[model samples]
Target: MTDKASPGYADIAAHYRRLIEDGSLRPGDSLPPMSQVKEEFGVSITTVNRAYRLLKDEGVTTPRPGAGTVVSERLQVASTGAARLARIARTGEKYAPGETSVDHIAHLRSCHDPQVAEILGIEVGDEVIVRRRVFVRDGKPAVAAFSMIHSRALADVPELLQPQPFDRFWQEIYTERTGHVTTKSPERRTARLASSDELALLSVQAPENAAVPVLVLVNVFHDDQGPLEVWEDVYAPGLWQVEGEKP
Candidate 1:
């Protein structure tokens, strides 16, 4: 199977799937890293990544930095969900002169995050507007976040979910509709252990062993009328530093 002409990520994914089915690759068996896979299969790094991503999506493997990728112990692929949003930006101690804008929306298929569910005031499987993004610092993944707004609030704005994840600009749409603006003010901050879902998305290895601390930010958006929106929990640590200016 390794001796093939121009194998794609799907092909590599199949090979790994077969290994798992045949018992050659069992749960907890660490698969070769991208470097090794490239050497063995003579494929590009991107191809290897796609293969790994497929395995990851199928609940077959988990990537661990320095330790390589391994078959999931339970073989049950946990939803990555908003765990990626828990990352913090490590640079930019001071805000830039211009306003920073990120116009993107991650569609929430079915989120089970307890905090997320509570913030959006929806059931575990209820549909919501999930937005995930990584604020980069110097071109490196810095702050990773998962944000969800009540589906009811977004149902009328179907165009928000078209063409791409970040289809409609959130601030513009909100202000135009109700003369409100989304404000980000940290109400509280705390630390916690990174979950399995977070470990996978952030590509963190030995998260438990490393004792990585996550900073959770609760940002609220409001209008002159009242509280317009609330992001109950946004988590990150080691990836960002906070700064403020006096008016």
Candidate 2:
């Protein structure tokens, strides 16, 4: 373990990296016990320590006096951006559920985007139900997303308008409406500097990394009939992991 970036150490570090990226290992989530990880990876404690040290140096995970190694509270988006958001969308995901609350919900009828109209198989300007909400973490805006549901596709499933967890409830509605499992989807994420309007919307207060930038993500869930929903999300700087897996 003389070299912290040795092959074994890198391999171990990479494993944990994937878990964090996929949103499977969320912020403040503890890494497995050293003994457990050693047995699983068939590596010595020195190698594990080296790997853990590397993660800490990169600011992906942190070493706590009593908590061992925990994932960083500052969001770590996977370089493969859309997958992370898709993971959350499919599972109603949250990093710190106790501290995360959805609020400022605005439901409106509009056909705002031509791309959305095409995806939902509606004529441009056809009405759609747009649900906009903000996810606040520690009383600050972390994520803001707009869920545009095709009015025709959402036909009869008014439950989406309620306050329940959207993932499971939406699945139930999908099965009830189409008599089949919900369709799979594709997602894309683009990183950019946070604009004034976005900054105001996020209402950022003392960001962890002032240099960190924002990311715009487009997620679409569709089937034969049309897209069930189209999501455009804005992830505030220092609060999301949009940087790719390379470094």
The candidate that achieves the highest lDDT relative to the unseen native structure: 2
Error of 1 at 220 (Å): 2.5
Give candidate 1's error at residue 193 in angstroms: 1.3
Residue 12 shift from truth in candidate 1, angstroms: 55
Show where candidate 1 strays beyond 4 Å: 1-105, 162-169, 178-186, 207-211, 222-240, 245-247
lDDT of each: 0.54, 0.66
User: TM-scores across all candidates?
Assistant: 0.46, 0.66
**Can you list the residue pairs that collide in candidate 2?**
76-241, 77-241, 79-244
Residues 9-100 of candidate 1 have per-residue lDDT tens digits of 88777677655543567777898778888878888999999899888877678877766889776543211112112211222112121112
lDDT of 2: 0.66
Among the numbered candidates, top TM-score falls to: 2
